[model samples]
Each structure stands twice: as C-alpha cells, then as structure tokens.
Target: MATPDFVLDLRAKIGTDPLWLCGVTAVVVKGEQVLMVKRADNGAWTPVTGIVDPGEHPATAAIRETLEEAGIVAQVSRLARVGVTGMVTYDNGDQTQYVDLTWRLEWRSGHPHPADGENTEARWFDARSLPSLSDDMARRVGAALLPHGEAEF
Candidate 1:
C-alpha cells in the first residue's frame, strides 16, 4: 500500500512510533457478488481498503478507495463497522493502528481490475464463495453483509 504524504511527513518526525490513523474498507456489492482485491504487498485478498486523506469524510474515502484501487465506482450504502485495528508493524519498521470505518457499498460502474499498483488483482466473487481472507478482513465483510442498520462498533 502507498503511504500518504501526511503520514510520511509525520514519520519523519516520529520515526517508528505508533500513529493512529483513519482508514476505510469498501465492501462493494452487485447482486450476489462482492468485489475483492489481492494486495500487492502481502497477497492477502480483501475488500477495497485505504487510508483516509486529511479532512475527507470516511464514506467518501470508501468510494474513492474502491475506484482508485479496484477500478470500480461505488456508492456507500451504509457504514457497517467502526473499530480500531490491532497494531501493525510495516515492513519499513513503521508502526500504526487505524480507526477503520467499513462501509457496505453498491457497485455503480466499471469492471474490477487492479487500477493502482497497490493491488495485484481485482475481481468480483460470489458473496457465498469468497476467497480466504484474514480474520480482520472477514469481520469487515461480515459487518457489511448484515442487514442495513446502525454500524457495529
């Protein structure tokens, strides 16, 4: 994943110290299919995810990430989950944790592809037959699949 410029600036001052950041996971659905991407960094298959830019709305971030990472245009249906992630130690020795906002999105246009280099592959899979995902990613998907209502915390 590409680190944002603001994060890079902060890293310059804080070194490897843990930083709290906002992020988004976009679970884009079209009928019974869901969009997923294979990460270029770790090869983990997951819903479209990205760091929220400064001052951007989380819902907008979800939509933006979907297009930037997966070549899919989507609109947020609802915020499905809001939670803090476990500490992540990046390959470059940077440590961080994200307050992740997962949103269920409705696919609007475009075919899925790894539009940005952050992912190796992007495609749709049957909601009931998705590829294996990490527990955290699975939880995000699960939250998005629930009946529309208040976001899970």
Candidate 2:
C-alpha cells in the first residue's frame, strides 16, 4: 500500500506508534456488476479505497478515490457501511487502524482501468460471481445492494 505523505510525515515523528485514521471505500455499481481493484501490495481484489484527506467528507473521499484509483466517475447513492475495517501492522512495524466509511456509489461514466499505481488491475465483476473478498468487503457489498437508508455503523 502507498502511504500517504501525511502519514509518512507522522511516521517520521512517531516511529512505529499506532495511528487511527478515517478511510473511505467505494462500492461502485453499474447495473449487476461492481467494480473491484487488484491491489498492488497484496494482489487481492477489493473496492476502491483510500484515506480521507484531512477535513474532507467521507463521501467526497470515496468519489475521489474511485476516480483516482480506478478511473471511474461515480456518485454516492448512500452510505453503505461505517466501521473499523482495517487493523493492520505492516511488515515494517508500522501499525494503523482505519475507520472505513464505505459508500454505495452509482457509476456515472468511464470504464474500469488502473489509473494509479496503488492498483495493478481494475475491472467490473458480476455482483453474484465476484472474486474472493474478505469478510469486510463482502459485508460492505451486501449493504450497498440494500435499499437506500441511513449509513450503517
């Protein structure tokens, strides 16, 4: 995973101290297909995700991430899931937890492509025949398919 510059700066000051951060993921749906990205770091398929920039709304971050990472323009239909989704310790000893705010986004334009180095591949998958996803990804996708409502926590 590419560490954000702000995070790298904090790491320089705090060493391996744990940091809690807000992040956003986009469950981008176009008809029966959902967009997924193959991560450069782990090669696992996941939704377009990124850290919420300081002072940015999670929904805005979700839209930005989807465009930046997968070259897809989308509009948030509703908040899908909001909870702690990533609690990880990197091989370098850096530890972090992400409060993942996921959104159900409707694809508005553009095809899937890896627009950034964070992902190696980006493609749309049949919602019913998706590649293996972590429990967290599965939960978010399920929530996104539900009728619009208040953000889940």
Candidate 3:
C-alpha cells in the first residue's frame, strides 16, 4: 500500500525538538541606501534584527529591535517572510534556534546609533555597497523587502 506524508504530523514532531524564539530584521532603506550592522560578537554585518519578547507580536518586535539595535525608527510595511532558522551559536555559549518573522520596514525617523546590547557598529550603505554577508542574511534583505510579503497581521 502507498502512503502519503502528513505535513501536520511532521510539523508537530519538529516543533517539539527545541526552544524557539521569534526574531525580526529590517531591510531599512533610505533613498538609495540600506542600513546594516557589524555584530560585536561575530563581526558579521547584518540587518537590524532580534528576538521577540514573550508577549510581543512579530511586527512589534521588528519595530522595537530596529530602535534598540540601530537607534532608528521604522514603519513596518509588510511581513516579508516567516520561517524557522537554524540554531545559531555564539562564542559566548549563547545559542538560539529562531523562528524569525522578518519584515520590510521603511525608514521613518531618527538617527542610527548602536543601542540595546546587541550590535556595535551601525552604518548606512548603498544597496550595492553592502558588505559580504551570509546567504540567509542576503536573501532576507533582498527579495523579502518587497511589498508583496505577507500581511499576516
């Protein structure tokens, strides 16, 4: 007899395996430039993103993280993507398995400064002037920033 795979069953099994946290990132664009940060820990330049608090929604997390990490305020335009990311470990023994809900945010107001305890150097670069980044980071900044991302809110 032939059998079909059950998506819900597979999801349930996967969900039970680890601690998951919600995170957000901004594809913050101002004119022809985008904002990125070099993480103090790893020195990898990435968009401003972080984990959502216990009672916070994904959109709220995105806005809060933008202000916290980059010292800039942004209007969350649309949810670019919602997918689970692999467990990323830090040198400090802090490991996170993330269920990232990233969004396309527009530069609304304020200046850039490194705040909150996450990043060190924050700078604006022309989209083309962006530095080499991991593949996951690159995709989240590229195709995900369009208005077509889910409006799940």
Top candidate on TM-score is 1
In model 1, the clashing pairs are none
Ranking by TM-score: 1, 2, 3
Per residue, candidate 2 scores C-alpha lDDT tens digits across 1-153 of 777899999999999988999988899999999999999999999989899988888899999999999999999999888889556899999999999888999999998999989999999999999999988888888888775777778
How does model 2 score by TM-score?
0.95
Candidate 3, residues 1-153: lDDT per residue as tens digits? 011134234435664344456677777888778889888767899998776666778788788878878898888778776667898654534355877776888888888877765777888888887899889888788755465745432
Name the regions of candidate 3 deviating beyond 4 angstroms: 1-17, 92-95, 147-153
TM-score of each: 0.98, 0.95, 0.79
lDDT of 2: 0.90
Each model's lDDT: 0.94, 0.90, 0.73
